[model samples]
Target chain A: MVWALALASLALVSPARQAGVMRGGAAAPSFVNAAVARAPRDGAPRVHMASCAKLTEAAALLDSVDVFIFDCDGVIWKGDSLIEGVPAVLDMLRKAGKRIFFVTNNSTKSRKGYVGKFTSLGLSVEPEEIFSSSFAAAAYMEQIKFKASGKKVYVVGEVGIQEELDLIGVPHIGGPADAGAQIELKNGGMVHHDPDVGAVIVGFDRYINYYKIQYAQLCINENPGCLFVATNLDAVTHLTDAQEWAGNGAMVGAIKGCTKREPVLVGKPSPLMIDYIVDKYKIASRNRICMVGDRLDTDILFGRDNGLRTCLTLSGVTTEAKLLSQENQIAPDYYVGSIAEFAGAGVKA
Target chain B: MVWALALASLALVSPARQAGVMRGGAAAPSFVNAAVARAPRDGAPRVHMASCAKLTEAAALLDSVDVFIFDCDGVIWKGDSLIEGVPAVLDMLRKAGKRIFFVTNNSTKSRKGYVGKFTSLGLSVEPEEIFSSSFAAAAYMEQIKFKASGKKVYVVGEVGIQEELDLIGVPHIGGPADAGAQIELKNGGMVHHDPDVGAVIVGFDRYINYYKIQYAQLCINENPGCLFVATNLDAVTHLTDAQEWAGNGAMVGAIKGCTKREPVLVGKPSPLMIDYIVDKYKIASRNRICMVGDRLDTDILFGRDNGLRTCLTLSGVTTEAKLLSQENQIAPDYYVGSIAEFAGAGVKA
Candidate 1:
């Protein structure tokens, strides 16, 4: 009964049903390119939002999906604390035979750390159940069989990236050192660099400055063969409803400008993060998967690009006006005010 | 006379004099455009270096100019210390009726501060004798009569820019605060903003961080009419032979990426800095002025752009190989091993 209700929620919004766009199976196209994602796909408008405000409308969409992917910062939690009713809604999803995974562009945390946070918040989580940009970067390096055996990693980020690298036995430098160990410049002098640094990884670095970036250039600019990788390309991090923070993209962009090159960004919308998840956890069907988040381009667009359904939550970012905006090309299959809307309302007994 | 010998130096390298290109008078062109600077102007090859290395050859080139504009960092001093034989050469120029003005893109010091430095380096300089990028920015603001009455300037630079603003009584905020007074980010939280921040000036700040850049975005992005200005676009600040520090351009570029705008750059290669000088000094003939420096693009290209004859010295950033390289579109009228070569060694007593 609950499955039928969930199908109704999805049917209320999905353009796939209207235009017969859900050409599932082997015929489902691979990732859509930028040009295709810009305009409507399969004769459907490029963007859409759920029409019903009732919990049952959104719950029907949730019940149809077997796996749920979430963006952390603006969706599940505000900052260090968990969002209200998020745990209960997640618990209900789990009881209904759903696979849950947390995908974040916040390159500041490792997957293990995210799992720990989930456990602390009274939600069950396995290490594989969370995918962070940091881990995505780590996994990417592993997949490529990165030849950083003897060379050190020059990091322009926090400790989260370092932890992931260490797990894979990668040596890194230039991250957050002990307190008061900040490098001082003599007027306009360059920082001393290590000759063995073969790769440069940039994430969310709070202490980013002239010396760190100059050192990164010394590695990449000096050596043309060096690897230039960044965790995410988020423009800004929405902290709360009224406040925002500069994301890892700013630091990454600065270095890119200095070196006159672009980095391989390993976050949402890249397909690298989601690709790693799908390859590891074999889901039943692509249409039965959903990504829920508070942003458009990174979350909903990422879902649309990868042939997965998406739900937009208004509890954090992407206000209703923004969702309905004509300027937005990113669209989702279902919508809810918060995950709290799904708690104890439409789930089966 | 020294004038005849100096003309000989110009005769040695002057495509202008050789090819009858010295078509001076009111008929000479105004400022050269960016595309013109990128390629050879007036059927001239893209790049030319001064041929004579002897002091007599350099002095011959020097004698043709009355006002000589010198770039300080590489042309005069290596860092805090003066280049070998610089003070004596400057003195010789002053005695030869040459109006010696030190024009530095180093936004690290104000004009008065430069005077102190010149005095300490055994070279006498009045405040009018030195034109720094800091003073140029201040002068430009004054020219526009920035109506910042009861408004504060958001400074994302060091003391040099602040000092110039203070001299003009333009109240500013966000420079070197007390030591250990760095602002920390609470995830995506916002910093309190000033209601009266009318402009944002960017320079090299050692203490730049997330909070600082975010605060900058708030001022520029939130206020559509705010002025965004930068000192220079130098990719790296030359400190020593093998070292370089990050320049103001990196900081400016980040804010540009965030706000999707460009800042009005007020340094070398930008006619604004030199325009202020030409207007203030009221020089008679454009051909009577010679811009002398160590770098090609910033100093030599700057000279070419402003209709001034240019000279290059090998005391700093541009190596002889780089100067002679065909990749360079910037050409100079004369070149020497050092400005010291133009002292009494080659000039008439």
Candidate 2:
């Protein structure tokens, strides 16, 4: 029934329908066994942050969430290094007996790379606890049973995607190596593509070239039942507090424009990440889980869309004014100036 | 008035208006200060290919086109080698005292590179007779007087774009060199953007990385009234009869998606190419010129939009069924099984 519905959604070329499935939202994210499970509350509450009363209310809300899902790049680290006060807050949270997961949309780093980074940052994180877009993408493929089933995957990313695919035992082609080492591109020449490729997975690739784009396009256009999947369609990546960089969306947009097809984004806001977490961990009650994130669209939307209680930390991307004025904006149940504030507001430092 | 119109169009946020100015079409391609000139006919009759009678009709129609505009790929050559009957046909047409122009949307090759290719193909052609999107892009920048005017161009393309910019004396940054050689993109660490940079020109960059896209986005976002220009938005490049590569549209689409702004495309179907041709050559009567190409949208649309006759050649991209069925499709004045077929039908071979 789900497969049939998915196929049906792909056929609707209307703009309204484009939002339903192409975004990885059509599938039920976390209601594992039953459709009758109550859906998560939408637009929960506005935790005004002007007074001590609101601060206590926000802390109480954070205290209730059994599992705390934190976003990486903006929340815990900036670029390759750890953010200040993040490690301390994380230690405090762990000591308070809360289950923690680091969810990030940055697909450039692999799980192994992330494991090393976590150790360096003085945080005890399990490989399973880190759910990056790269891993989620691989997990998604596995969920759909697209791993080494007489089909190869075409990658448009860096080492992260390759590492995840290797772990899943899925053979892949067309990535950074061929793109970066390319010396000459003849206007009209012998163009080659792997015919066995059945899926094109796009992530945050630094060496995103025309050759890769062409190869990916060929794989999708030539192959039947080829899946066009992207890690995340993030509009921008705040590499630091002062700078914004082009995210995976830029790379995906190029392929999207060329193929005139939408990709199944497997990152935050897609509900796919939460699905991966819930399915793997078998969370007893999802209602107790709270998602703490930096950005509204990816982190907050992921939490909201996946039926988890949401909290927005001003420590990252969202400003209070921008978060408040937008219509139908995903309102978090709690808001704090920073996650660092959590240490002082009733939580043991 | 032009700036007001440009701003108004930008505000419309409608797809139709996106074509008006963002594509460099708002500024007239070339009009020699004459409002009394006769416009070319639209939706003109196509020469039938049913029988010997239709063959003669096609031959007669070809006889009327004094100036022939030929699209390079698929028309003159299939890939790197020349197409079967193009050279002989060109020779015959030249002997018949016809003015010819080779126009292409491939921005990867410069006019000199095109000249070398033409020479190698045994065609005696002048550098000025060849009008590529690369040349047109440079000319457009030159027309706008970007060089030495306290402004620089940030290119998202390869050697062709650099060569053209070099010829026009336009100092450009963010091309192939800086991108392919980039290591460890330190997010938000001393990003050096030329403050005088006023235009971001996107062409076919095979080394299209996240770094380049980010720089291009920053150039446009940071600089006021920076021109967002693209060579062509051709969906696919026919590398050979059997293979298709991702075109400039993919690269341009990335920047457009990231920047959330439109680009001024100076290639076919945008009418800017023909405008450049008309203005530079100072054609007394546009009715005598004919645009011959394989694609309907780019080639036929270019001719139709610029008030010139158009012909479709089956040797390259379009199929008859697709050309006919598309709603409000750009129709041509003549159709042949191939440009080679024209030589066999009635024209000298």
Candidate 3:
């Protein structure tokens, strides 16, 4: 039952609420008050909810926004396959002079890696138009002027985080290289810690091992002024459409258990990525930006918590029945069968 | 702060209280009420606590016990080297006609493995006198008639567990073999699970990796009636005198994070080990049994929760300062600088 409550809070609660409940000492972002004020609280009437599948409604939704932030996995594609009509819808939005940005919580790939993915999916995208959680983590360190601290980062993630840190010229250790490490109990389980590790960044790591978990915990728990950062806490992730694999949350949980510390989440619903986007791109108005995605928890919650209008598409994890369930706390502004409806709306118009 | 509270509870709280707090649905063992009735409650004056280092008190303690249960790692030895006067203390206890049993929460080694270590330390001990958590796990399975269910076990531990399971003729899979297994995201992160795995057993593992964690989670979360069992939840363990390594709790935490399930603990303070020991050995009258150890949480709490007299040593993880701290909740009936004090007491006599 506690797990259920945790899951519910993770999936439906706003980032501010999550910050208060999960990360005890984290301060809510400045933009949270405005977003909280605009969204309907639990037990409130659902009068603002609408279906944007119809041509008139969809076109009205499209016309209201100058910028569109899309979640990649479920919105534009699932796994390696592109979603139907996504490219056409993107072209139409571009023709209408709408700026587009691909925002993803997937930290397994960097911005350049995502460019390769986008190109392979037949979508033209620039590195600047992508904001992965890996990029957010790197940008956060730069924002805090971490390089001047004269301490390195201890990574418990994959190549994406390593590449992003490399891009920013931030020194780090212990990622894929530590995957094959084995604790030799015969020689005595004396694990050495690097005292210069001032921060630990955890993300989705397929090669996660006990050595990395122990090393990261040592840095976070023992190093002075050390930071614990999580790229995302998504409980499960889609590496393929076949099934959900254990997400980075599992990796983070291991260290959290050992160190007994809460990580500063830099992924979706944390406002870190969106704030970075807003400051970097100098986005004029939050009211003119719309977030389109297929997940109620990460994508929709991220949008709602950052003062952006949100549209829920049923092409990925969430479904219409789930959205309409009595216990559902999150209410998206608009719902469609898929993002393909946008192309249909253009054609009808 | 929560971790501190959890640690305090783990080390000091009686099993009944731990059951009520941590394992919500489980019922306290029949011996719990008597144990709770005998121990001093928090906020009460610890009047029964005594220093057994004096010859008078030590001789009185030695005179009252019919059986002695000693915690291995911290009590008899730390890693490899035996503590000073341990052999003489054991010889004295044996000559006094006191039955001795070596009870350990270290699931990394089975009873047979312990015999070799004891012999190497120049102490003669029979396998029947050892009660490792690995043996308790196997015994528990037999007690519950798990074999009749025609289901195999999935192990997330080392060879100790495997050896114990083999002794019981229980079929199992996934241990050292799964250590090197990698998740091939290139082939789609679709991990197949064996439908026959009806239980998962976790313990301190050096070669812990993502594949074992993911597989165990799948079995516990998806498979029908799949049981999750943990050998122990010790936060930190000593492999040598150098420093503490992350214990089995970290390994269990990874799976717990993903599965959101509580495990049936089979180690110290769980009553499972003591219950099995009592049942198999036909030990009568718990009143005369003395539990001697260096740790307060597992060893002393195990004794207190099982209605046995408890003695704490300052030779391992716990110190006298901690025992006398204002925040201390659990109180052992007797305290000593080390078991070597027993030898001093004998010499004085």
Candidate 4:
């Protein structure tokens, strides 16, 4: 009986049904009108405006979406502890036949690693349902035919980037192994650049040191046609809920400063991950997809720039004042107190 | 007899004598006319043009200077081996009674350490005559009355910064000790920042690691009114004469990325070092001081920006093609094949 009810809910939120409701504005839900009224029209100058979807309009907003993409950190959980009602809301979305994807700019984890994290958090997730920045980096390299170049990639990151590159059959060097490496300047030691290194990928690395930075810069600045790639440029990352630590941007900036060159960003707000998802999953319509995240710059801007509906959650890095601040140029289409508001219970706010 | 000849040479190149020559343009040496003709006039559009001081005119150029400031690394020596004729040039300059100061942006060594390098290189140098960036950082802190606040500084650099701070009686922490420190994310490790830190100094450090980057960023971002100071932002440095390695800019860039803050630069291209030198040594005139270096951006730009005569040498990181390129905006007053040409021997070029 539960399966039957789930099937019925799935049919009700089908992509075709959602597309029909979107095109026929007269038949659209009240929340659609509320969101569309504040959103900029096509070809119009984009203004930062978002509607606070009330408890009564929450169901209507969720009913209008056929696909849902979520940012893992801050949205799903803060560090190791999962946010309240996350499991229930995820289960509810699954039952409603909403296609879900876990997208994260945290390049410290691979898709398989994310699956493990999700499982440990008491949420069921498959590797295919997750798209980490590390995976995006690998996918980008694959798209560029880097594997055919027969040259190894110089990594200034962690094991996650190495694993992703290994998955794609692209050889790499200089990751966590360089954590203890020292440049004996007292003994007149020098870092030698490998001629076979064709690319350097930077990510959040706890083991980042001067040696890795020197190697990455040497490859990027000296090697011919060497590509400099960054998994993400997040200013700070949540190692734990207690404090924010230096993010991948710190590592990438070191190389950027030395090389005086910018890297090819392949994380959120770049449109590369969404493009990869669209091609791989055959996503029908962008209008029927909703991107739920915590950050305005990375998550909300990522969705808005990719023509997807965006919902901002206040349970993460952003606060209510920050969301409503005039300095915030990128606004979402709708906002809720948290993703916990979608638990089907009465809205907490 | 040597003292009498030195006194005579000193009177011949006195400030007043050089000033008279400058005012009496028609009677000035040929090299002076050559330099003035190519140099941009006082209110004219500045163009990148530098005349190669011929072998015949080297003596006249040397005689026109009351004070000589030399950059150590590429201008004086490559690594351990001193450049040919460096000692002879120093002897000749001293015999000519010119005030000489060894100004270096390499923050890896303190003034005392520089004296040791000079002694080992078979050159006579006093600690008071050397103005390293490390000393400049300490001087800057002293000028800002940082010690009165009773707050300690957090260092993300080598022992040079520490030694200078020690010389100034300022408290500091986190240098080579943090090099072995690791952030064990798997064990849920966190970096605890000290609350007593009022400033963070970044410089060229072979021991630079993510722990230092994180601690520095936390102090700069979370601590109120904390200062971010950089010894230098040199893109690259000569660990040896063979190749260029990452400089302090790489370490500074990491903290800047995470904190999103600009550092108070105390090294070359910043007037802090020259200002400290002027205040301490009481330099009479900027025009009578010749700043000799190899790099156009840091050394030449530093001299030019400070109203001192600039001379570029070709023995360091910069090539003649780079100096003459259309994109090069900062030009020296004169160019030479190398500092070796100033040895009073015939110019090799």
Score each candidate by Cα lDDT. Answer: 0.70, 0.71, 0.77, 0.79
Best lDDT goes to which candidate? Answer: 4
Of candidate 4 chain A, the 10-residue stretch with the lowest lDDT total is: A47-56
Please report the TM-score between candidate 3 and the true structure: 0.80
Write the candidate numbers in order of decreasing TM-score. Answer: 4, 3, 1, 2
Per-residue C-alpha lDDT of model 3 across residues B1-349, encoded as one tens digit per residue: 3224534555664544343232111132221211222244566543322212112246656665689899987789988878888999999888878789999888888899999999999999999999988888888888888888899999998888999998988899998989788776653557898999999999888788878988897798779999998888776667776666677778777777777688898889898877777777788877678888887878988887887777788888787878766456666766777788777446434
Query: What is the C-alpha interface RMSD of model 2?
Result: 2.7
Considering lDDT, where higher is better, how would the candidates rank from best to worst?
A: 4, 3, 2, 1
After superposing candidate 3 on the true structure, give the runs of residues whose Cα lies further than 4 Å from its correct spot. A1-57, A63-67, A187-189, A279-291, A294-297, A304-312, A318-337, B1-57, B64-66, B187-189, B278-290, B300-309, B319-335, B347-349
Q: Label model 2 with its docking quality class.
A: acceptable
Residue B98 C-alpha lDDT in model 4: 79
Candidate 2 lDDT, A1-349, residue by residue in tens:
3333423433543342233222222242321112111222355343322100113333455555678898887778766556777776777778878789989998877888789878887877989889888998898889889864779899998889899999989998867676654534465454577788989999878677767888888888778888999998886776654666777878888998788789998888887888777777888766668788878777866775666766677766667766654232344545566777677633532
List the DockQ of the predictions in order. 0.25, 0.33, 0.40, 0.37
Q: Pick the candidate with the highest DockQ.
A: 3
- Each candidate's fnat, listed in order, reads 0.32, 0.55, 0.44, 0.57
lDDT of 2 by residue, B195-248 (tens): 778898888776677678878877887788888999999878765555777778
Per-residue accuracy of model 1 over B1-349 as CA lDDT, tens digit each: 2233434444554343333233221222222111112233465545322321212334445555788899998888876668899877877777777887888887778888888888887878889888888888888778778744566788887788889998888888887762234554454545777868988888766566666787777888666578888887766666554465566666776677566568888888889877877887898766778888887868887876677777789887777777655454455655678887777543563
- What are the per-residue Cα lDDT tens digits for candidate 4 across B124-187? 8999899899998999999999999999999888788899999889999998888788776643
Per-residue alpha-carbon lDDT of model 1 for A31-66, expressed as tens digits? 121111223346553432222122334445655678
Worst 10 residues of 1 chain B by lDDT: B28-37
